[model samples]
Target: MSDLAITLLAGGVGGAKAAEGLAASVYADSTHIIGNIADDDEFHGLWVSPDIDTLIYSLGDQIDRQQGWGRKNESHQVLNELEKLGQETWMTLGDLDLATHIFRTELRKQGVRPSHIVHRLAKRHGITMPILLPTDDVIQTRVKTNLGALSFQEYFVRERCQPTVNAVEYEGASIAKATSESLSQIEKSDVILLAPSNPIVSIGAILAVPGIKDAIEKSNAYVIAVSPLIGGKTIKGPADKMLTSMGKTNDSKGVYECYAGLLNGFVIDDQDSMDATWLETQGVDVLVTPTLMSSTAEKAQLLSKVIEFALAHRNVRAA
Candidate 1:
């Protein structure tokens, strides 16, 4: 067991970006992505897995770069038609993207779980990497906000994330069990990554699933998390606002505290490099590097820093 090699926990955009970095760093087949399923919802009788779809589209080169979601150059014919039919058009599903929902809904109707549906979809897109859903169960993230305790999509899409979130909860997580196959991958990984995804919603939702975090705690692999916030703001999404609403500052310290006990190491952006010494005082190893990845080269370099940082930590701890 030369440290069995790679497992990454991720959500959508931010997570997918960092995962792309890791994917390029290793043999794609060696990577396992344990993605967040809390954002899954049934739209117009079709099962839509937002996080899972983002990972696929990102890797498959179909992502809408400017929007940071949906397919690039996507058309909204299906959505427009649905609107004409008096359907709620709050959530936008593009024409090219509809093919995904159509395929997934059919499989799910035929009794396929989301995890398996995702695997089939990824393979169809020629992706060699393995992706594991944290659970095959219906564990969704619900935002306990001023508006209401709404499902992630309702709070995020239908209401446009305007609600003031008081807390985030994982619905159906208490009974949710981690899949054995996914657990085995965790057992085999050399390093377990906590992607720079929204910590409370994405990674938190996955950890809330019974048995998952316990396995990570018991595993021998190095657990690394990249901070999503840099200089009190997020690259994309309302993570900063979410943190503030939750009473955590929009800073690396808050993000660090979110995973303090679980993580063996953490990555902070170069802009927050000054915080490294302060973080080290808290007993968590810190790696300051350019966490932003606007291109393939930058992504690989960021991942390289992660690998380098982990190996260095191993050597120090072993000594």
Candidate 2:
């Protein structure tokens, strides 16, 4: 098998799960990620990057598995006190996790670009995989729903995804440019994996960055994606609803259509076998297997399969 230089596009939860599996199955030095920044926000005057923090904590084996985000064994004393003082405490900032926010915010205030700050944060957590944002510029995703265009956190977390999303737009994508690191990673990648992240919130936001889509389309790498939806439902989050609400197909097929010319291969669950076969005729190579990540062993198994698929398909070496 040819050694691979892999680039992952991801957000939190499902992305983290697939990341964990991939981390276990590959040389850490060979994998890099373009992390999702859609859910970033400020709380208590500090910057909180929820998805990036989730990646850091998970890679460091310190994630609260039950909650799926935040540090393991988190202390909420600070949040409790804030609530007692009648502060807006919709977002909980844990004691140890607070340190990250404080450090990142301070760095930002000191003119540290977000990309540099992210690298520093990842290093502090001993994360081996090189991860960067699509850009250092602020590009918040805004969900336009019945409630109007709200920041991603406001739409998803604050409203609990209760409102109907009529459209979603990246607030600053019109002039957003991909960082040199992101462009370089795409150029050198042998295999690019889009993890099973929320399509609308995570993947969509990444693609919204102006030149990144064109880069992926023109890259020499075999770009493959694991569908976030399985069995006509999202494994988590609002991808299914968002797809249907937009008058688009809401299954793995919908995901294939979303990627269009960029994806050379699509990995769907065995349950979506029919969709996989149909997508094959559309010219996307299909890999079907169990995509669930209930435990470390199961995750490893799926990762092993994905790696094998990437390698075998690498024979074609996408142009």
Candidate 3:
């Protein structure tokens, strides 16, 4: 349906994968993405939005396929120079990737809205679909670990997620102003999907923005979430460890509980059929399929099923 509108709440590599899948699917032109900016940090005096850039690079066909982030054919000349200058180069920014951070920082200094900057960046990358930001206001993810509170980048990229996560705080999210574009998209969408990103940090950071969750709850769109876990473990990242540390069940069912009443359906991998059954018993529509996105074809395959499930549910609701 060309007229159908879809909105995605996404962050991190999993989010990028889901965005890519939708970009490759029939809904490419109609899909709108709201990405997490909680992982954003300033490095070398330049602002960097890791999750948002990953989504843009992935959708624009410029993402490094191997790492699931950053641009392909990238060179780290800038990072090397910074290293020689005795600057902390722990957060690696490639020569080309540095340009994105530069432009974004400049825009921010000029008082440009974060949402407009994302739209501009997406257009520059040849991405036609809208990449909306959850909020134009500044919000960051602070991880309270055994080593003390660390910025999301420090805990993730610098420390390699080795520290125990005691808690996660979305600094400024409660006071952040939700972007009108994002809210409008949620209101008009026929379907909204929470990509298989880390429920605690990635998707959690997005939902922490006050108006976002409320908008999703109030919207008529059929909301669905894909579990990031397969066999009670994440293929990549510290979602499982964080979940356990935060006293949540380390499985797909826990992932569902994170969103609770916001979801109309939940999608889990075939390995997590137990969770599927549990979710169904709770009166939630469940879709069990192979959710590991190893390639574009696989991503599209999974998304196609999710779309089918959404359509089916809509029909049932209508009946």
Query: Each prediction's Cα lDDT score?
Result: 0.85, 0.84, 0.90
Prediction 3 TM-score vs. true: 0.98
The collision pairs in model 3 are none
| Candidate 1 local lDDT, 1-319, one digit each (tens) | 2334778899899988977887677535567889988899999988888888899888877788887789898989889988999999898999888899999989888998778888899998877778888888888888999977999989888887799999888889999888887788887776888999999998888888888898898887888899998777888877888989999878888888788789889899888887889888988789887788899778878877887788679678867
lDDT tens digits, residues 42-136, model 3? 99999999999999999889999888788999999889988999999999899999999999999999999888899899999999988999998
Model 2: per-residue lDDT, tens digit, 113-205? 899998888888888788789987778888889978888888777888888889888887888878999998888888888989887789878
lDDT preference between candidates 1 and 2, better one: 1
Q: Which stretches of model 3 miss by more than 4 angstroms?
A: none
The residue pairs that clash in candidate 2, if any, are none
Q: Select the stronger candidate by lDDT from 2 and 3.
A: 3
Best by TM-score: 3
- Write down the RMSD of all candidates, one decimal each: 1.6, 1.7, 1.0
Clashing pairs in 1: 5-190
TM-score for every candidate vs. truth?
A: 0.96, 0.95, 0.98
* Full candidate order by lDDT, most accurate first: 3, 1, 2
